[model samples]
Target: MARQTSFIKLEGTIGDVTFYKGANGSFARQKGGVSRDKILNSPAFQRTRENLAEFARAAAAAQLLKGAFREITLRAKDLRTHNRLYAMAMSIIKSDLVSDRGMRQFNLGDMSLIEGFQFNINAGWNTTVYARYTIQNGASDITADFEDFVPAVKVSRPTGATHFRFFFSAAAINAEANTVESTYVASPEVEITSQVTSGFSFSIPKLVIPDTTQVYAMGIEYLQEVNGNLYDLNNKVHNSSKIFLVEQV
Candidate 1:
């Protein structure tokens, strides 16, 4: 028999066993070493194994994203847009994680999930004040391109407004507190409107992060003009979300 101190501690439940954090700043798995061969052969362990497999899949899927999005401020508590970046990343993982034959895997050289439309675009006076944007990123930079034709925007585009700011920051990996708190580097934003939509096509260049950072997070803040005033329209949680967009430098 092994002493409890001899093994690492675990914090949560996985499969039928529970894990905890030890006093020495290390992790330890609790007693009860159910053999894998026994689990595979026992009909009674069917549901148990199935659940274990499901968690295994979620864990692997999380790994594919965690490091990539440590700095993004994600606040959707229910794992939806309500939760912001975290929800978005998990949704992407859930969409891309596929189980075939007996194994699960992602489908790509890199998980390049690009989304555009509705939520990315906010409209006042219903949802057609005319706004459209694409938040795209890859192994290099992130680009936020959009057009606004809400009349007032034609003459009043404020660069200082966090209204359309894009951010990148460090990640929190330990399941502890978010390291970003409220810090992130803003992406470069240049007014490309031929005036504002009805003008012409425009392109906002890619965003870049500092060379010293690795694990990253990303987020955007949105604002709309009403009565000569700008108000927030973003659905971010806590403030940011996890990001998989890596800076290639």
Candidate 2:
């Protein structure tokens, strides 16, 4: 590989070299490597083929998860959420002890591995909200419980933020079937300076689906109230959300 310093910034193939623009700048490399046919049919590249298959499985599973949480993650996620989830998905798929290496699947792996994952790295749930809370799954609903919660003291208020709210979302994802059932619920907005009444809680119906993985998320959103409307503070840069629990049943 060599850097292209000529006046003509070229892309595409030029004789034996292929030139292209990358993040670091334009560069050229010789177009000589293993052929696609050889990699697919050769005995020596069997491991490579297995790795590609597993990679595809992980990528697909990651896409499914992203879709499952798309509502809360629309503004609460970081730029690298896809890559981060992809890496975790690969780890989860690799943990499938019952399946063969190349044939590993999400249904056979531990979905709990993704529990406690933060969608936004900048503002984490634990760091933004100091109040102690417990999440419990009931027969019909999932509940997030908080006792003696004080917003001014327990919550980390960002600049120009006037009010905040707590949100809960759950999804029942069936990886094998490629389907999802989900719901979202939120607590009433409270002023940042006011005290949240003791024994505050938020609940959403439990989605019990056969042969599905249930994932729950809890998040805090900050808002600034104008003359008559509420707007997101800091363009959602300080919004914090996390995966509170994951259960495969």
Candidate 3:
């Protein structure tokens, strides 16, 4: 390989210049300041080095996410779902990454957190007309149990409700306000309900979640049949908050 910069044995600094013996058996003089060792070891450069390291790790993490979620069914092949999920996953695991002066704190270091985590109904979705479900982690799957309520179904049931369904993603789930937007993924099944439910439960089948394809957010959608037409709750008239999301992990 050709030489890059000439290797030099530099002497003492002179004004803004320093005399040096080049590795190619030549003499040289150039602007000089601090020693290479001193600059490299300086505290000012430590943060830069740390930043470089963290960037490398984040890049690797992104690649790992791609590999794990390769089988993830998205709206498109090169969609940003996996990237969004990767960001979410890193916010949990690599959140505690710090510099030389940062206080060390314990945080999730890898994708292990996706294996098990608390699921909760989003605050916005805790509206009056929603059925309640209890989460249970069993040996085989995560079961959401819904039973009969005192008001015959749920406390504040969506009027004319006819269907209930589920969808999941690594990012915050959103529904089309009025028209169906080809933005997100929906679960395959939409259970038929009788405007009022007797209560229903769903057992989400579990699998060995890979770091690349881990799911973190889930949304439950309710549909109402009005005028012989099924309408979504997020039709702008329903406050556009139709999808009730559960934190999957």
* Top TM-score prediction, candidate number: 2
Tens-digit lDDT track of model 1 for 1-249: 222455454467678556565555645454677788989879988777765654465455454344434333232122333234334444443454444322333331123342321122222112322345554554453444555554334323334333343454533222112112223465543232454444323222343333222344444444545576666544442233334433322
**Candidate 2 C-alpha lDDT tens digits along 58-163:** 9999998889988778758888888989998899899999988788987678888989899999888888999887877888888888878778889999888988
| Reference-based lDDT, residue 51, model 2 | 94
On a 0 to 100 scale, what is the lDDT of residue 176 in model 1? 16
Cα deviation at 48, candidate 3, in Å, is 2.2
Instruction: Name the candidate, 2 or 3, with the larger TM-score value.
Output: 2
Q: Is candidate 2 or candidate 3 better by lDDT?
A: 2
Each prediction's TM-score against the native? 0.36, 0.87, 0.41
- Candidate No. with top lDDT: 2
| Candidate numbers sorted by lDDT from highest down | 2, 3, 1
Give the Cα error of residue 214 in candidate 2, in Å.
1.0
How many residue pairs clash in all the candidates, one count each?
22, 0, 5
Stronger candidate by lDDT (1 vs 2): 2
Alpha-carbon runs more than 4 Å astray in model 2: 1-13, 18-29, 194-196
Q: Model 3, stretches more than 4 Å misplaced?
A: 1-43, 59-90, 93-130, 149-163, 168-195, 209-217, 222-249
